[model samples]
Target chain A: METKDIYREIINEHNLHPSHHGEISNPTYEMDGVNPSCGDKIKLQFKVDDSGIIEDAVFSGSGCAVSQASCDIMLDLVIGKSREESERITEAFMRMIKGEASDEELEILEEAEALADIAHMPARVKCAVLGWRTMEKIFKENRQ
Target chain B: MTNIFKNDFEILHDDKYIYFDNAATTQRPKQVINAVSEFYRTINSNPLRGLYKWSVKSTAAYENARSKVAEFIGAEDSSEIIFTRNSTESINLIAHSWGLSNIKEGDNITVTILEHHSNLLPWQMVSRVTGASLTFIECSSDGEISDEEILNKIPSNTKLVSAAEISNVLGVRLPIEKISKRAHEVGAVMVVDGAQSAPHKPVDVKALGADFFVFSGHKVMAPMGIGVLYGKLSLLESMPPFLLGGEMIESVSRYDAVFAPVPEKFEAGTVNAAGAVGLAAAIDYVENIGFDIISQREEKLCRLMIEGIKTIPFTKYFGSRIPETHSGIVTFNIEGCHPHDVSSILDTENICIRAGQHCAQPLHEHLGIPASARASMYFYNDESEVERFLEALKKVRSWLGYGN
Candidate 1:
């Protein structure tokens, strides 16, 4: 419940030096993630090859620490995985943040486990979920 | 002895409820609360419906509240006072009933950029239906409002000009009286959103010379579900009823029915009479304290709040830095923190301030910022609360891991 617990040292580090914090050279798919109430907006771009392996991923936008850090950590996890595996990881992260991830799922959630504490923050759930939601949209759109 | 005013409201005694969101809605006093309870307990009958004793007494209570509101706002006739749910509803009644009926193609509906969405959106609807284009008056960066914006924006094609007496977001008072004069000179009706002004200062709609004036009862120490809209007698007569139902009719039939006059015509269905009565009690409480004292106390508190924010090096004020221009509101943002983050940290300290755009997107867009944090005060708040708020605000950047 303490405010300090919510904004950990790691979140600050990730926010300051966000991974893939710029646009992709030529993204196969990209989409916008917006939380209008909080004014957090993000544009997610990814380069997935014909084999469905995500070759590159980058995110660019403005938001609070939780949101920026969430997207950065997320891009770092999903970049080398196949689009199929990326979708699975996105699912587990969503489940983890909602306090529903099993032990096996948390093990796969990777560095995103640092943010599982976001489950306790009711107001911040949206910030933690923005990047994962964006990833889900990209994969869903590609399936079509 | 100076803190005696805090005793009127039970909520102020609780050490945790550091309520600084007075601009959104104010905390009700015990007297206002008891008046509402007494109405439900003793005189719980529909007004203007039956000739039974309870009904007559209820009608008397309701009508008396109307007169109190009329007197409170300095309306010449009680009939000018029409009750609605809140300021939003009151303004909507004006737009739907008056704007729809009167506005025509090629006419212009003038409004300011700083209007709350309640004040801004209705005009947009009216303009859309009538083919009347909207002309927005701009405010200076320091939130200095002048009649020049109106005088320049309002052409001879303008039919009506609506503006807020004080902006809920910027916390700066607008020059409504000067704008009213200009609007009149240009043959336009002036509408004032007095939601922010009435609660902080003594409001005289007639003196302001606005055609339609509105303020919510809840923001002035009354309960919710009640608001006052004071329209010029002639203007109300010209517009049709916004809502049509039983009480607003003179005589009903299976076919066509004759409508009642003016205020009642607009106030359809069973009225919020209990809310009106509670509003009257609130007015009595405000009058007892007097506007002169209320303004002076709030002015001092606002100045202290502005000073405290200034002391924090990274804090950036959104409106006028001069405290005298503020309507007991201080909207600001931290250099390295988003407003939501700032307010979230402050909330952990039990300090309640409004974050986000404060429902004025046009104004926020004009200011070139997505959102800001607001700490609005009322007479119930004091210097100690300001100190507590400043202490919490100072920690926001640090809590978000920004360096001291």
Candidate 2:
């Protein structure tokens, strides 16, 4: 896709009804994330069953459109997956976001392929990964 | 294009480079460079330690530079000026030496929300080390703090009032004279961080009524790694040396050691002779141009830039819009675009500017913004450069799909 198309898609997704937005009811786990360089913040929450599978995930916060959309997109990827499977997905997603994925791995991130254009713009990379980092922190803390 | 500083420095670009990142550091004049080269080529010897001819000449040159610095800032005695690595080290010396000795439990050290991290973090660490508490005086929406507000914040436990004369991020010109007087009324010593003010305008420590004044030489058009810390003679005498080594000692024995007096005691190691000479040359260059002319020129440039930025529909300026309240900086954010993105786009044009927190994160938090783009002017920036910057900013806004 063209750079403008990718940017337009991100901007549209940001302004339209974003997925995984709003608070989760009676969340079992929650974590706060902040981008210190810019003061952007997000609070992510999740519900996990006794089998360590994520039943649901939601987030609420204020930030740049890219950050909001990135989080919304990330929430759609991890719901109903086991905690171990979610970690593997997050690692694969990060590699794709950083433009370090193999061709076969690139096929896995279908709708998320638009984020590949963000790698050329260094400043927006943080915006592209804001939600993913927050989710990573949550799972890392859950294990501990 | 109109020449700001007589084209003394080459532009190497069109319509003059918008050299607005003055708070980070300044471009050196030809005179400062020549002075440094002359020092290295001719009198290359350490000061005060040797009695040879070259050593005596070098020592005299260094002392003369010290005297020039003292006179430039209206210091009562040149012996009260101590050279350090930069403003960070100068403030650190004060925090360690004076704070370690004077502050006790329950004492309060008041600073403001507009301070650079260099001024704020040192006091924060000092307050943590000692049992003292750190209090911050609130700033107005426009980034100005009233003298009355500062006075009101000085409780009975307040021991010091540390403030910046001009904020690096906001460009707010604080009323140092009034604030210093109020601090003195409360029996608290006032310290002024002159890193931003000293480069743009005249600085008279005595007139400001500050107990201590600190500034970096590089910010004032000299080379890096050299700065000045000026304190009152009595205050200097009371505080112990921060670092101990060869040059700062008066006499040493196996059992006992005597320290040198005031400023010499603080300057514990070999000094930056070339850097000091370059600073003195910078002072001479500024004096020759006349500070009143420089101040007027920079003020006019700032006004022009502010007016230009106001025309951009999506741009929201962060600090005081009143001309008198702001100095040479214009910080603002373009709607719908992050500051880092704005900075990257501007960089493609070789238009240097500072983005992100500008080392005043708390101020950004208070302003309810994540980051801001700052364009700070100097005496050398011309009006044509301001025009070019505005045109480029409009282009950037359109490119980001924010401009109609």
Candidate 3:
């Protein structure tokens, strides 16, 4: 698919059935991500087992369809992964979003690689990263 | 309103250009552009520092611009006008100098709920630094605050009342004269953020009884990185200097330094001389056209937009509908569509409008909305452009699947 096609696809998928579009009933960690420039906000929460593995994650917020849907897709990507592995996934995602990834790094992105085209839209880059950044903060604090 | 000089502005070439984002910035007139260009071509020299001929000419041009701005705003003396980067830095200068010097522990400063973050955040930071308390006078449903509400919030220790003369988001023209009178009665100095007002109408700082007035030049069809800070000479003399550099000092010893006069003391270091000249030319352009006529033209456009937008179903408008009591800003949101999406659709038509919180997030929170789309007008905008905007907005509504 062309870059615009991929972007349109991501926008369409997120708008139709947003992932992690609801709150987590009981979770170990929660954090709010706010993009002050445009007033986009997202709240992410995760449930971790005693062994420090990510059991589940969810998010809720009011923003552009891009941001809300990005959070939804981000939740699906990090679930069922270990805390360390999730952090690595977030770092890899940032590289892809910023368009700084190598060919090998592109392979690592796997399913989330559809969002690499967002790098061209500078204004919407923050929208694509809001969810991943929030998850990174939650895991960073919980790990320590 | 005349077309004799219309061709002078490059942005006016295409009649199809719908520039509704005037509150953000305006297109420079030919005279202002020529003045800036002439500075680099003919008289390119630093002012106040060098005694050479080019320097003298540059200094004279800069000072002449200051005098013109002082007269334009009805300041008592040209010496009272201080130059800064923009309204943000101008307000910051007051917060650091006058605010710190006057406001003490337990001192109260009252502001209105409709202030731009430029006017609100400076006082908030001042309160945090000085231990003084900051209180916001609530705005009405129409975005107007009454004199009674202002009086009720004025405590004995209220040091200042900083307000926006015209709200960038609400398009509501505040009763600054009445508010200033009430503030003075309680011994609080009144500061007006004229960033939105100065561009739309004639501003008389003396007539408004404001102790300090600040506005950015870019919003007035001048260049960016230049702004004016008008203060009473007494107040400017009493406050500490905002920045320390070469030009703002009278003499510097090993240990202590004597500062220059009021305006010079506030204007530290090399100023934006070219930008100041361009600003003066902008003022000259507006004056030649007459503010009353300019304001009248804008009011007509505002009414046209209001009527046009109201006809669209599910279009909820915010702010004052009264023409006389409003600026040129029109903020609204469709029921189902987000402001960003509306902005994207409008961008397709080349009809520029601002979307999102407009740097007034707390006000958005107060209004119980996440964000809004604002269509701010200027004198250059006309009824036909507003019609085009309304047409585009209708298309945006349907495309967003709003209003079945």
Using TM-score as the measure, the top candidate is 1
Highest lDDT: give the candidate number: 1
Model 3, residue B191: what's the lDDT?
95
lDDT tens per residue, model 3, A72-130: 77777778888887788788889988889888877766767887877875657887788
What is candidate 1's lDDT per residue for B61-97, written digit by digit as tens? 9999999999999999999999999999999999998
Model 1 stretches astray by more than 4 angstroms: A88-121
**Lowest-sum lDDT 10-residue window in model 1 chain B:** B1-10
Task: Write the residue-wise lDDT of candidate 3 on B1-404 in tens digits.
Answer: 34443566788767656788988998898899999999989998999879899999999999999999999999989999998989999999999999999999989998888888999999999999999999888888689788778778877689999989988889888888988888898899999999998987888898888999999999999999999999999999999998998889999999999999888998888899999999999999888878888889888888888888889888978988775555788899987667876776677677889989998888888888889999988777777788889988887655543335
Q: Per-residue lDDT for A1-144 in model 1, tens only? A: 355776764457687677679986778998999987677889999888889888998999888778888899898898888988888898899889889999999999878888887787787789889989989988887793
Model 2 misplacement above 4 A: A1-20, A48-56, A64-129, B1-6, B11-17, B51-54, B395-398, B401-403
Candidate 2 residue pairs that clash: none
lDDT of 2: 0.82
Measured by TM-score, how close is model 2 to the native structure?
Answer: 0.88
Measured by C-alpha RMSD in angstroms, how accurate is candidate 3?
Answer: 2.6
Per-structure clash totals for the candidates: 0, 0, 1
TM-score, A chain, model 1 = 0.94
lDDT of 2 by residue, B1-404 (tens): 45647455554234535677887998888888889999989998999899999999899898899999999999989998998888889999999988889987789998888888899998998798887999888888788787668768877678888999999988888888887887888788899999998887888998999899999999988889889999999999999889988789999999877999977899888899999999999999889888888779878988888888888888878778775456778898888777765776677676888878888888887877878899988778888788878888887655455426
Among the numbered candidates, top DockQ falls to 1
User: Against the true structure, candidate 1 has what lDDT?
Assistant: 0.88
